[model samples]
Target: MAPATVRRDPGTVKPRIRPSPAPPARVRCATKRAAVRIAYVFDHRLPSTGADTEQLVHMVAALGEAGADVELVLPRIPGRQVPSPDDLAAYYGVPPSFRVRALPGPFPTVRALEKPGFAAVGALARAVRTADLVYTRNLPTAVAVRLAGGPPVLFETYRPWPDQYPASRWLFRGLLRARGSFRMVLHSHYAMERFLRAGLPADRMLVAHNGWDPRKFEPRLSKHEARTRLGLPMDRPLVVYTGRITPKKGLLGVLDMARRLPHVTFLLVGSEGEGSVEREARSMPNVRVEGWTDLASLPPYLYAADVLLIPPTAAPLSKVGNTVLPIKTFPYMASGRAIFGPRSPDLAEILRHGDNAFLVEPDDWDAATAGLRSLLEDPETAERLGRRARADAEGGTWQARAQRVLDFAAPMIRTA
Candidate 1:
């Protein structure tokens, strides 16, 4: 190759454009004098759903904010590729200390569960060696914790496994293996009570509640504003029901409530798998089905709502729903909307028939309808109730939640 001599004109005023240096790589670091490391195992993989991803993001941020180095490991579907570099970069957008790692599963169902072999054991052991605590999500990660035995484990269970999946019994046995070594974190008093009856030691149990963002779901928005944002009738009251469109969520009861209260429009937000409530609610005219909403987009819908309905069905499908309180409770209350549900002990602490919330007996249309009518007819009472609900929700943030976990694991945290 022949080199050509380049000539520069002395009089030429070249554009003074400086190439933008590659954007500096962003890094999140732990702030504690001695960073506490936590391994958080959850159900989120790439392209995750709304609530699962939101909970994962919140926990990661909370742990990082509390000066802990938090790393998340979620199971990946079999044959699915790991997240791309750009995806990995986006995942790391969380606090610097929050790292997202994906483990492979052979089959789509329980492949993320293949962590007990020697190779898998060694990898987990190495990770656990540096970790002060292990926080596991559902049953799958609970199994992984039993295999990796370095740190004190804290299992965050939303539902009892055996009830949801018959196979869960085998998986739950793993908990017994880690019984003395691990602690269970219950989301509601209902869960605490149920697990206590199941024989888990009281000393091994702790409760951490969930919360919401006021800017997203609050009374700050007028009916007209919320309606405009959500594309609903500005004059009509909006009642919202969110969560998996399944029987346990009490969608049928919500539909019945909608039927009784023809004056209000129902907003059903959630998705279904093979057979779902969304499929069943298709015949309703007053009900609007929004399959699923991202965490960032939930506020408008919440603001547009006049009330948050939680008519849970009396189904024994899983211990998860029956025992654990739904995170929706905090958001529903935080939205400054009246909350109507059965007198569940898990949620009883927050509801007062005519105070912060309205307690309706399960499938009690007469009672639920009566409560709805009172709130709709009297705006003053509704506003008062809504305000009280919002005030009560302030105590349910993830920070408050993480503090409880730390308090329960104080012995291990101090050692770490």
Candidate 2:
């Protein structure tokens, strides 16, 4: 069943669609280089509530804001209403800066159809000469475009397909050796190192970490104001985790920590669907497991937290590489609250121990409990960590991150 609609924030204005063939690309005149015309090709249905979908919308919006003539080439499912620019902008809390070009493809309702639409829309995107470079997460699509005598490809991914995905690693390596200035973007150095070891030249791959849209987090509501809005308690100390309520994300650790520390109220604000994890997490006496809060309504819950908790488990997903870093880290940092999180290499890239955040051994439930308690007990320390974190977050804005990506890919885009 569809969730009830969230009332739009009154202060927010609808994105203006300038009368043109599409919205006129905003170009910063001071930039010496020409605006890079980018066709960001995607394989999924739009306006969905996935983290990757959010990342895509925010990334393209920032790319557009950074003075790129960007267009999104996506699949067209016959019966579905294509998500309009306003819908994308409004849903993601971003500016309507890029255009969407949807080409006819098979609807991915069945297992066999999931991979078909991507290559079709991608090939069509390249065939039309709509962009000087086709940027995609689809590695195979990148190869297809290059082999079809199309323009340059800037492939982006969180997975290190070049090294680990046994089937494609060999093919990708071959592409690297036979290529004409091939380029790729990875989300973290952890992923980048894999590509480097796999014979992708150091200069060919970039680590463009995922970022947050500041509008969703900025002009932050105060703790008191936010608590009142969310109907949370004022008398008790509250710690919050505002993402998926899965064991892979370390929710089981959160449950154990909650049981050990009954004095502190634990709130889990983003569970979707029912499962043993969800049932067990909700059944905890002191924990409040709210189901699937919409994007627009989630910030106040963060603002209301005394401490932002991202529990650390010994090993998530057991063997396969985990989603090492959580996207919530950005907003959690942006919230200006002391974050209590895991000590992992991926998070180590951005979060510092004893600097902006207090980190404890992942899977060390006792240590996490002790650390969280210590943070909550000391208000001065908490405030200092939060201030430093917020200051650091200013540098990690999506606008800033996007500019860096453009700068990294600038030379490649130019020659293409």
Candidate 3:
């Protein structure tokens, strides 16, 4: 029997998710219960440079670890180069166990023709048809797979869309309640709530947080060694923040902290390398902003830090369709550095104040400044917090995340 759906509010019914038996405790499992064939579809430029690409590849690799035969299907945009298996493997740092299929698409310059072309290819691909299900983060692929009567769709997302367009929203709403939607995976309960409010069924939703790959951080380097390797100062105390250097992520607030704490170095890794703010960052005497660092090279930067910051401001985020949970959180936890971040329901799912990290209210520069000062003043407490963060991080590995996803999709795979 399917899970029961209840009407919480008339004319604005919100959805709820039924939790699985997968424990909240340490998730170090690779049961390999049964082999499930999955064709993961995400149409984007090959050799992606964004964090989203990392998430997709890791999901496929983890699924493979859970005894699933997985193939990553993407569009072969005309005139654009497609990355070889080895290229992707080296860049993403994952075992090249699955095949990459580049289906035909329209000319790369033609934006409108691309989605239709990608969808048409998905509708006819043998990899998609033979698999137990078509799992996709791409909206076009999800829409295509269902309309063309392909396998079940596990449409996973962090938020709902088509809010402005009535017709598109209507179609997506139907797709959510459609017979072919096997599961709708969300990254957090905050995201789950967004979809629920968008009218998804209780049983149809699953919340699994994004995870980190432990291999990247293992054989951990010491702060002395890391700083030396990166040519950073040996004498200064560091407060580091990794990921996009945009105002939406509360960089402005972070910059203010640099002004207040002239003695402590505030480092911003992964800056876009140009723009007005970055120019201003270079002007600051206390702030040291570095250009975008690759994933493989990021651990050293993180390990060199005394504290990690994720200061997301009023960016139309937090328990919404936007990026509430930063991708760097897992790695920051794995690094065992004391984390200082905004206190929101979405972020609170992983980061806890006075527990794993030191939390402050979102968009509050004064609270953030005071929080960092407190952590710096008391070294013992900061070390204690870092230890707890590392201990808890053990359960949120890439493989562990894969096991949880497999556990949730077990029923559908078994029948397939």
Candidate 4:
């Protein structure tokens, strides 16, 4: 240092070199990456029975998987039986990301009956205010959310008649005329057409078919293995039907078929306790009825079956049977089992005769019986139809369905 100082002038002294500062550490804008928060409002309480609960759970899970934050909002009443979060997650197979928010309201029973009352409305409004979108299949809750005026509302209709209240119809028509901010999602082509005829704007309508999770419903065990595990007869040709044991489900026709074909075992997997349908089924030597089977236990039963029965009531034109497509159809198709059912427009949309399913005339026991017999006797045809049905189901998972709905609502969601 002393030698350098002597040799160089102070003004011309050299300085040590240093590396340029690293580019500002890359930062991701969290707002841009945040998931769209959705408030899923429902009029009914959870831990309930029926296909609606299953559909709602799976749809919520799918929406979460599709990058949307879903929170289930329902009325909360003191001293009511509500499922614990852990129980709900286990039942629905939902991830930790999915959540449930119960809005404080009057008693659960009263709130359920009068869902859009003042207290319920206040609760729903508060819940929806924090969300990017409000989704509901319950008409009253949908209307309430729409009126609350926070997030964009999406109303999904599975049945046409149930939501066609005179007041609701008038409100919907007015909303369409005013180009209201809400949208309607119909479950089937028939439902879309019905809503269109009912004065909903075509521009705001989306048709989303019911779907299943093949990973849940698909056959994981051999037929013999499943039958053995379930203690079902391994030798008999088993025809299975899984749903409420109601007459409107064409259980009468199934009973008739069971009587006609004594060799075939008719396994009816759901009954409302020991109700009339169970009594009728029990009277038949070939028919066996079991109480409700949980979702996890259903796959083995479906896999054990040779054919899946989907018999709608005699009145294919009835509101209960005709206007709505069965939610069970997708699961049946996903089970890789031949489906035999009446040829309604709802079924026709997804099923092809002699291809994925055997479509027969509605309420025609003779035709249904023949179809079941054909599936039982012809292994090649049954296998062919089942494989084709499974292939078709591959395209209709709950994930695909949720994505479709999200895509349809993308513009609205972004603006919201």
Error of 1 at 47 (Å): 4.0
CA lDDT of every candidate: 0.61, 0.73, 0.73, 0.72
* Candidate 1 colliding pairs: 28-96, 105-111, 159-320, 160-320
Shift of residue 260 alpha carbon in model 4, Å: 0.6
lDDT of 3 by residue, 134-246 (tens): 88887778888878878878877765453423355466668766644567788778776656566657676788888887777866988898899877778878889887766
TM-score of 1: 0.77
Tens digit of per-residue lDDT, candidate 2, span 64-172: 8887888887777768988887778867667888889887766456536655556755765543354667778776567767776566677888876654576676777
Off by over 4 Å in 4: 1-33, 111-113, 118-124, 161-168, 177-180, 312-323, 414-416
Model 4, 380: alpha-carbon shift in Å?
Answer: 1.2
TM-score winner, 1 or 3: 3
Worst 10 residues of 2 by lDDT: 1-10
Q: Could you tell me which 10 consecutive residues in candidate 1 have the lowest summed lDDT?
A: 1-10
What are the per-model C-alpha RMSD values against the true structure? 12.5, 5.0, 11.7, 19.2
Candidate 1 global CA lDDT score? 0.61
- Could you give candidate 4's per-residue lDDT for residues 192-257 as a string of tens digits? 777767666788989899888655553477789889998888888999888877776767777888
Pull out the clashing pairs in model 3: 15-196
Q: Residue 101 lDDT in model 2?
A: 83
Positional deviation of residue 391's Cα in model 1 after best superposition, in angstroms: 0.5
Off by over 4 Å in 3: 1-34, 160-173, 176-181, 316-321, 414-416
TM-score sort, best first: 2, 4, 3, 1
| Tens digits of per-residue lDDT for model 1, 8-82 | 221232222222223223222233345667777655565455455666566666666555667776566567776
User: Ranking under lDDT, best-scoring first?
Assistant: 2, 3, 4, 1
